[model samples]
Target: MLDLTSMKINDNNDNNDNGWLELALSSNKDNVKNLIEIKDRLILAYKNYENIITEYTTNPIKSTFLQERELLKSFYEKAPKNLNRNLLEQRNEHLFEQCPFCGRPCKPSILDHFLPKDLWPEFCIFPNNLVSQCDKCSTKKWSHYYSDIDNSVKFIHPKFFNLLQYIGIQIEINFPSPESIKQPDFIITFTLPRGININDKKRLSLHIKYLDIKTHIREYITENYLYWLRVSEQKRYYVPDSLNQRIKESYTGGNNNRWDVALYLAMINNDFIINHFDSIEIKKEIQDHSDIKLEILTEE
Candidate 1:
């Protein structure tokens, strides 16, 4: 949900420096030569990444080494930790604490093969082919690059696409009734800006759907909205500005695509919420910071 277009990882370890690969294949010397020979070919396929999305059929990056797929994948797994550690570390410098793919407030701990290593073993160690992602997003994604039914790309490539510039997340809150304000229904949605083409929009929508982004967003909003409401209620004077500032703080240190921040902004902007701000119920449990407030009393 954030733009990682500026992220440059493993710049020092390209085709020229196959030392990492060499080390990985040191034990098994037989395939080392074969892999090293195909280094240029593998890098070419990586450089042609953009075309792969559009033309999966004709792209030359398919799984060709059928018999050696496991061996190639093992090279990626067995590579010495220090060799490609930069790929993990540098991704944090640009993305900060946000996962580039989902904008979650966690460092992307796993290196997910943008093109699954199982399917395309040639690009197993290709730095450009790996994406830093959170556990849930990586597990959920699980080698699904495109839809089997339609043959379209399933999600936005964080490194390739400028996500925040083109797509924005919007929240629509629905109150049960004007008089009652126990909790509102938090609806999460995507808004494509003017410049994006229909095809890109379709892809983005599919990306959101496949990743279950809307559900994650709704859960985030629902869990945090009441806490924010409590904070706003605590500020007796200059409530609007204080509330807005509070909401902005949630996303200020990280990516702007935070769903909780969006939900709070939507609440503050809504006329009904602003007008009836005082009346909105802040549960006693929320105010006390613990849901279970009842103390067990023993009868004498």
Candidate 2:
């Protein structure tokens, strides 16, 4: 995940109420006697959108808060055009080359609502609340998360934390017998900075499962693991550190958030992989394989 700080909000056209942001912020409808009691609540919500939402928390109101404020459905309908033109198109950079949610090399064609607009319809068009993500992240995060049950933030909000920087993911491949090498179990585990609070940790773990991020990384890690296995073998298992260095340097040019970057780093530093890559038991998996070639693995 790219750090929220990596990209800047394009607020050049925003007015005092921050234009669309106000409509979402006012959706909570604090003390209004009736829907008729307050008018222009949308403007109020937009004006206070930034201050109302925090980096670590989201509203838990069950009855679509924005609907109580006004005809929120109308705003939801028009959000895409504005989000793309006003925010995405205005940006000088594409924000990220890969989806921050999955770390795949795909364009952020879909703008995802960090908080589902269904529950918090008010934020449907809120610039800060929307994220540029791929279909995988968008489809996977299909409102299964309900932070109100535990009062914990379910995932890292790009508006709040640079999760990609403070959090780390390591992939573990449970090798099978030479015959079952194709079906190895790939386990993804996470480690966070020591200073991170427990609440954040809970959400981070939830975020991984919520998006099925590890499962997504499963195939990539296995392929890369197999590819690296082949890389070491073709070189006749000559120099361990030299080959590890080559792999590490190749992925580092991308960024801290990339999956391959983390994968190569973990494999290179892992004592077991280093000592066992050249073993006859493991090399057999590569030597006997006919599915893909080592040269092509690097191409992917």
Candidate 3:
């Protein structure tokens, strides 16, 4: 789990929404035309709302508002079928990766709602409240309602949190868990600044709960363990001295260290390690082993 609060929203001036609209227009032109058949119905609904709003002279009645709501809903129901698909695809492409909480490469594996759409219908379509989430961190599953605080409804928007500065990932080995007796258990805790506001803390907690990040960490660790086990087995009976001698006799540079070969093989087989290993740790580990040197695969 990574803190990813600093992902910036693109400027509204840029052709973001318009681009999506254009894409939808081009791709679903025929469908859009078909939807035009309902234009008369939408116009009728709008006219009904206008008539109620204009003719009702008494104090605004509850029924009037309800009627207006129904009218708007009906209009939308009759709208184009692909009206929002392009926007959704565009958002998926642009906001799908990078943790919304920490703005890191946790590659937001999911879409997150800063505000529960069901509880806060007004904010359902609010762009600022939508965030990309990794599997281990999101707001969808975790309920944000707090009983202790009065008038506390809003969650800390990732746009305002700048999560990279406020949060850090801590991997706890052999962490105590209720399920420990049943299987290998570990916890990846997301540490945050101690003085963070209660609402922010709750928001972060919800993000973690929704993502099931601890599960992701366990899976990652298990996969690495198996990979290392395989490598260990491959080198169980190998004599490094004899291997190096054979290589020297044959004038081949490949068999210098079976241990090194084993480690490399293990790394290659582990997807999580290949994808998310700490570069700094790798550098320090390489430095500790005088027999090996780290090589830069890409320029920063």
Q: Which candidate's TM-score is highest?
A: 1
Candidate 1 per-residue lDDT over residues 1-300, each given as its tens digit: 666666534342543455344455444545566666666655565566566644543323456666667767766765545544644454454445666677666667787787777777766766667778887788878867767665577777776677544556788888988865547877677776577776677777777778887777777677776665666566544355766786767756544477656776788887877766655334433555774578899999
Q: Rank the candidates by TM-score, best first.
A: 1, 2, 3
Candidate lDDT values, in order: 0.65, 0.59, 0.41
| Cα-based lDDT at residue 104, candidate 1 | 66
- If candidate 1 were superposed on the true structure by all CA atoms, what would the RMSD be? 7.4
Model 1 scores a C-alpha lDDT of 0.65
Please provide, for model 2 over 121-239, each residue's C-alpha lDDT reduced to its tens digit, 9 standing for 90 to 100.
65556666677887888898766546667565666666556665555666665555555444556667666657888766777777776778877777667786677666665764444
C-alpha lDDT of candidate 3 relative to the true structure: 0.41
Candidate 1 vs candidate 2: the lDDT winner is 1
The TM-score between candidate 2 and the true structure equals 0.64
Query: How many angstroms is residue 67 displaced in model 2 relative to the true structure, after the best TM-score fit?
Result: 4.4
lDDT of 3 by residue, 1-300 (tens): 223433433431124554222332334443545324444543343334323323322222232223233332332233234535533543477643345543334445455555444443222223444566655455434545332333332233445454334555544334155434224344455567578887667655654444454465456556654554444334433233333453355323332112222223434444444333344345445656876667879878
Off by over 4 Å in 2: 6-39, 55-59, 62-84, 87-93, 102-105, 178-181, 223-257, 265-300
